[model samples]
Target: MSYLRISDTVVETYRIVHYEQTNFLNRLHGGDMLFFLVETGMLSATKVAKGTSLLASLDDVVFKKPVKLGDIIRVRAETVYIGNTSLEVEINAFNQNEEVVSAYATYVKVDDLLRPVPVGVKIVEENEEEKRKIEEIKKRRESKLSKIADRQKMRFRTEDITEGIRYKISNVIHVSPELTYDGKIMSAGKLLKLMDDIGGVVCFNYIGYNNSTDYTSGAVVTVAVKGLTFYSPIRLNDIITIRAGLIYVGNTSADVIINVIREDMKGLKEHVATAYFTYVRIDKEGKPIKMPKYIPVTDREKNLYEEALLRRGLRK
Candidate 1:
């Protein structure tokens, strides 16, 4: 079996410039972009791994650029290294101008049951079809993110206000599922799961880690729901955008800002929910690890921690 073959997977594309994707600055939110990138990476890896990995863990990521509406966004995934039981994959996101918006990610290999398989077991029987798929993914990588490039595109309802006070990233990041909420949104454990997903996305998509790695996610050292706000009740069909961005990096923990936005404006542009979370980075044994600098927010993100703590403290 050939040890390596370049591949390409065009996961998703959109001209969507909905307010739900922007933050208080009215620009595309970082947290939501992270979520989308990670989810897409997982899908691509599953296709290559034949559904053997359960997305065991993620490391870290840095956002190099921003993506806006009318900029055809494209995501590509490819295998860089593969082990008997895990694989290292790199993911890249591009804007219409073909500039890299984000990079890097890693994925672990799982077995037929979606559980982590043994650390060193062959996962796939290579074939020509797999090679072709890899090539297709590569073709996209060499091309521009927006094929329509310089062509003029339709401006949206909020196009004129790119500099306006933006909608906080609630809509892009923290999407309450269309299903009921028996406190799933507020559950500390559930919130931790969201944190994992967030980190996984960063490491796998932005930092170029692959799904076939051997590392596993650790435990939570700190999970503070800094603050949460609701404009109106969120219901079905409203795209739940769960967005997150880095706040502070410690030797072993990092703070993240998360938000969930729905069409709850009641037909207006009102933010629905927001949160500030601090998670401890840990190893497979669940021990805290150090993290360096990461992506930062562009809007007013000052002393929001103390504010979130106050809100989380006052029980309803």
Candidate 2:
């Protein structure tokens, strides 16, 4: 097998946070940051894989600091590990010198037919530092795999929403050409932005803001995202069904779970991706405000509530 140096797979890009990329509070949107990270990660992976790379899973994404408008954000991504058919990328975004966002994403190398293919190249460590970093990456991957196995055993159906403050909404959108990178499969970054948009809508609806006239009530801003996994790829012209539901609420924060389902022309539907987004309610001054508490009335609600609590604890 051929070997490629880790430096050969490094990709870096910079962009100024535009006005359109900011939220209502004039801060960089979390989803936009995710888009940039995924884009950079894919570029780095493709350099080593020698073909298309599809995002398979992302985890441990934490927003450390809020990026303001006009701030120049620099993102750096590099392939840290090479598996048989998959690779892991570590991406970091910084404002000047301080790190603001960090994420690890796994991508599967795919051929023209979109089938997983073995990566023909392996990463060559240049020094002890690179070797140590790869070891850490392996450890993290193993831990994540164990957690996924445990979560699968739980098998809690997220579609079951019964009473209480479980505000839910569904939106449909046609996957346009602009959303795809290879003119066929949709870009994961665009799908993430759509998910975050629907998630914010669900949070606002739960807090009693249903229309434009309710703007004076309050605003919701995303703080963090946890365990975003893409089980299948979305294709071009596919009808995407995005479902968002309020799962748990705290003093000033709430957890919204968004599920994306794709339907082809022939009417076959598949669950594409699912993630838990944490948002905080803020007033006109952008200060945290008290949100209405959520009470679990059904078994499903309780289960989801407990799971959210677990995720929250893990975040801490």
Candidate 2, 1-316: lDDT as tens digits:
9998888899999989999999767898888998998999999998889889999888778778889899999999999999999899999999988999988999999988888999988898999999999999999888877766744433333342323434888889999899999689999998998888889988888888755633676888888888887767899999988888888999999988888878888987777878888899988677889898789776777888888888777443
Model 2, position 271: C-alpha lDDT score: 70
Candidate 2 total steric clashes: 0
lDDT of 1 by residue, 232-254 (tens): 33343444455665544445655
- Find the candidate with the highest lDDT and give its number: 2
**Clashes per candidate, residues 3 or more apart or on different chains:** 48, 0
> Which candidate leads in TM-score?
2
| Alpha-carbon local distance difference test for all models | 0.44, 0.85
Q: Which stretches of candidate 2 lie above 4 Å from their native place? A: 147-165, 210-216, 314-316
lDDT for predicted candidate 2 compared with the true structure: 0.85
What lDDT score goes with residue 194 in model 2? Answer: 88
Each candidate structure's TM-score, on Cα atoms with residue i matched to residue i, is: 0.40, 0.90
